[model samples]
Target: MSSLTKNLDAIRQNNKIGHFRYTIGVTLFGMQLINYFDRVNLSTAGPSMMSYFHMSSTEFGIVSSAFTWTYMIMQIPSGLILDKIGVKWVSRVSSALWAIPTFLTAFVSGLGPLILLRVLLGVVEAPNTPAGSKAAGYWFPLRERGLATALYDSGTKFANVIGVPVCAFLVLHYGWQSAFFFTAIMSVIFSLWYWIIYRNPRESSHLSKAELEYIEQGGAQEDAQPEPGVNLWFVLRQRKMWGLMLGNFAYNYATFMFLTWLPSFFVKTLNLDIQQSGFMTAIPWLFGFIAEIIVGGWFVDHLIKRGLDASKVRKTTIVIGLSMGIALVGAAYSPSVWIAVIWFTIALTGVCVSAAGFWAIPSIIAPTGLVGVVSSTMNVSGMIAAIITPIITGAAVDATGSFATAFILIGVVLVLGVFGILVLMGPIEQMHPERNDSNATISR
Candidate 1:
């Protein structure tokens, strides 16, 4: 009998291999938690850090934006490298690269070194999101990808929820430096864990033959091998490429607003102390975390399985999520501080509800061997906004002494994002010359 046949029989007979896939997905999720923990820790430390360096608000914003400068530029190259080297090496090396800078962040003596280290942090961490997205695409089949993607993407929200409170405690006691030291330790630990546990389905010795066969038939790219002389120009030519990139800018504008400034917002606008602000920031992000994993990922998969067209289902869900993001503006207009947070909670939920679907799009539609490129291209928007928003918001706030203009600008961006996805993103399918449908056909 063929090895495939024999493996199928073993899978049918063995219970141990039945859910190895979940284990892998969860491990990826852990990596995200670690990745985002590093990002959020700085925010929890911001009030203290700003004072230590005698930094102006705009200068702090510049410091925040510094990380994304190289990070944004590196996305295309990072994606290509992940595709070439495979997720394993790229992920491990990138984590270590970022971890070193993260550890050194504890020692930054001035704004110059701080910004330099942040830039290094950005370059190394740039590969992470695309790599994680690739992990979802490669490991999970179409039916399960929504939740699978959610599982990993939710790590960012979870980091805010958990990382905020924990970092606040450390900042309150051991000092802000300890928070950096702690997250750095976790990154090193995750690198070792990821190396041992994660492997493509075909490369995994522990995965059942039955599970591998199931994944292949259901659209998981069991063979992620690139074709010789693969044409990336073709990927760049598709309208979906532009749509995804533009849409991401909108999604991330609001995300970075919260990630970089929410703690400061609580302190400055709401009159909360550092500890109160850190804990409060956790509340809205918790709503986001729950929505991403439960509402966005799991519910999307459920809808797709219930006979929805994969194309229409994902798009419609993402649109609704984007529209709900407008609620973020309401927070600025609220009468009470807690009331503003309530509005933020609702707005974050709306945004995160699209998280799984957004991550799933490239994996769902991108040509095999090019998922990394496509995913990376789409993710460049987030980096660009990360670079722009902090600096812009900080400058705007410094000039006005209020966050109202920044909030209104964010609302406008989210609206444009809705347009990008609705009008530009085409049917959820692979891009190829043989396909009869053109981008115009999917514009509706």
Candidate 2:
């Protein structure tokens, strides 16, 4: 039998001979889980810090946004670095560097130091999502891209589900500083693990020849470096890229709003204590984690495997998922805590489903040699929203004395995201950076 046929047979027979791509996916997922654990520590500790520092919600918002300001500025550069140096090296260095800020966060005695560390944290961790996207591009075939992307992107949801409660528990018992120390240890360990374990398909002795052939034949970008001249400036000028930016910006606005403010909302709006809020906050993200894995990852891939048009399937998934974000409005008006959790759960589940598809887009659409650049460009938009969301939500809550206005604003932005996806991102196809607006449709 042919190697591809034999590999397919091995997979069908449940022989674990050719599935190392998923190992890569799981590694990326672990990285993101740790990355977000670090990110969510501040949110879990926000109330205590606000009390200790004697800061208003507005000032606290600025502190929370400090991470994204540098994160957003570094996105393009992060992408360039990843593209220039390659994923394994850039990721290795970033993973080690991020631990420093996370560790120092425990020692900050004043707001200035806290903000400076947050900015540094942002600077170091900026390569994370783009690197995951690039790694997925290199490892998985076009057909399996959704699941691979979701595997990692879903880490954000899973982290929120568990990280909030864990951080809160640490904050409640061992003090807020304990949470930072815990995450810093996790980061250091993961940095070492990743450095030792990760290798591209070509370099990996553990990967089977059969699997390598399967991936390459199935459209994995094994070693497709960016063509000599496809720069970030070249990527920025595309209309499709703009659509991606706008859509991702809207998605991330809701994401950051939830990450930064959800616990505060539970305490301030629902009248729950920090411990109760931590557990309650986990419900929505728990549902999000499940939906991202089952719906975004598996179901989308299943549909494509059944011979559905890849573009229509992805577009429909994104639109329907983002449309469900309007449920945030329901949470805003909820009369009881459980009711609010239910609404938020629905909203988050939808957002998570769309994330799988969104993360897959850069790999699917970027011209030869520009996957890293395109992914980072898209992330820049999301980080911009991340910077803005906390500040806007915080100001709204302070001005209105409630979270209702902030929730409504997020719903409106979600709607605009749908429009950007439908109207601006015409077709999910690869573009030629050398040619003016030339798109080559790929057959699934």
Best by TM-score: 2
lDDT assessment of candidate 2: 0.87
Which sections of candidate 2 miss by over 4 Å? 1-17, 433-444
Clashing pairs in 2: 226-369
Alpha-carbon shift of residue 325 in model 1 (angstroms): 1.3
Number of clashes in model 2?
Answer: 1
Instruction: Write candidate 1's Cα lDDT for 1-444 as tens digits.
Output: 434434444545663436788888888888889988978888889989999999888998998889889988999898888888888888888876668999999998999999999989888888989998888888877778898999988988999999998999899888889999999999988888887888888899988877876666567854466555454666776787788778889999989989999999988888888888888999999998988888788888787777678788888888888788888788777888789889899888888887778888877767778888888888888889988999999999999998889999999999999888888877777766455256433432
lDDT of model 2 at position 411: 89
TM-score of each: 0.94, 0.95
In candidate 1, which residue pairs clash? none
